[model samples]
Target: MATLIVEVDDNKLKMVKDVLKAMGVSVDKKSIKPEKAPNETTALAIKDARNGKVTKVESIDVLFKSI
Candidate 1:
């Protein structure tokens, strides 16, 4: 037995599940709700973003490099 988590696009999600089902796979379904309010640091970050305190990135390379 194996378990995995996958993130899929909303538009393609049903097609993906249907294909897996047709292939004789069990798609044990569950939807986990997001936790409330986030953590303290995450809350602060969200607050900052809402307040327009973020820096604008000029290049995609710079964004990826920073991460």
Candidate 2:
């Protein structure tokens, strides 16, 4: 059997699932999560950046000043 991944809005999720079920398609309740990077350090850094847990460097002078 082939696998299908779909991303739907919260409001349309139920409707999409219902349609698929009516077509005899099995729907898994669990949502698919993004795969992490092979390097744990890189994955953590990416997560931190996404969450705004990063320092903003205005200019080279400011960056050097912090060093």
Candidate 3:
């Protein structure tokens, strides 16, 4: 047997884990935890999201303008 390492987005982690479980693959969740603490920007973004400070884009022009 060979070991494989995958880097997946946090939002997609559950999907990946579910697929692996269906295949009878063993997943070491502890190893998947972040090795270091989140950076300031990441921490701020998470805080903002939890506070419902998100903006909704209704069109492409508005999206590009925000960027």
Candidate 4:
């Protein structure tokens, strides 16, 4: 037995599945898991960025100074 893996964008998932089905491939829904939600730290970072809490540095010197 052989295994093939494909990563498809969310918007194109249905189309890709339909194409695979037409080609006689068995699309295993059970094996496909939904994407995981961001962890607490990542979620907070994203929220902060969305709320304009990001820092912009124009040079290495400035970046190192900020860090």
Best candidate (score: TM-score): 2
Better of 3 and 4 by lDDT: 3
Per-residue lDDT tens digits of candidate 4, residues 1-67? Answer: 3233344556767876786678787874323334877666556655765676754345433433553
Colliding pairs, model 3:
none
10 in model 4: Cα distance from truth in Å?
Answer: 0.5
Candidate 4 at residue 36, lDDT? Answer: 73
Question: Which digits, one per residue and each the tens of the lDDT, describe model 2 over residues 1-67?
Answer: 5444344656767876787788787976544346733366545545665676755455434533554
The list of candidate 1 runs beyond 4 A from truth reads 36-67
In order, what lDDT does every prediction score?
A: 0.55, 0.57, 0.56, 0.55
Judging by lDDT against the true structure, name the best candidate.
2
Question: Which candidate do you rate higher for lDDT, 1 or 2?
Answer: 2
Error of 3 at 66 (Å): 37
In terms of lDDT, model 2 sits at 0.57
Candidate no. 2 TM-score: 0.45
Distance from true position, residue 9, model 4, in Å?
Answer: 0.4
Q: Give per-residue CA lDDT, model 1, range 1-67, as digits (tens).
A: 4332344556756875786678676865434339664666556655665676755454434533664
lDDT head-to-head 2 vs 4, winner: 2
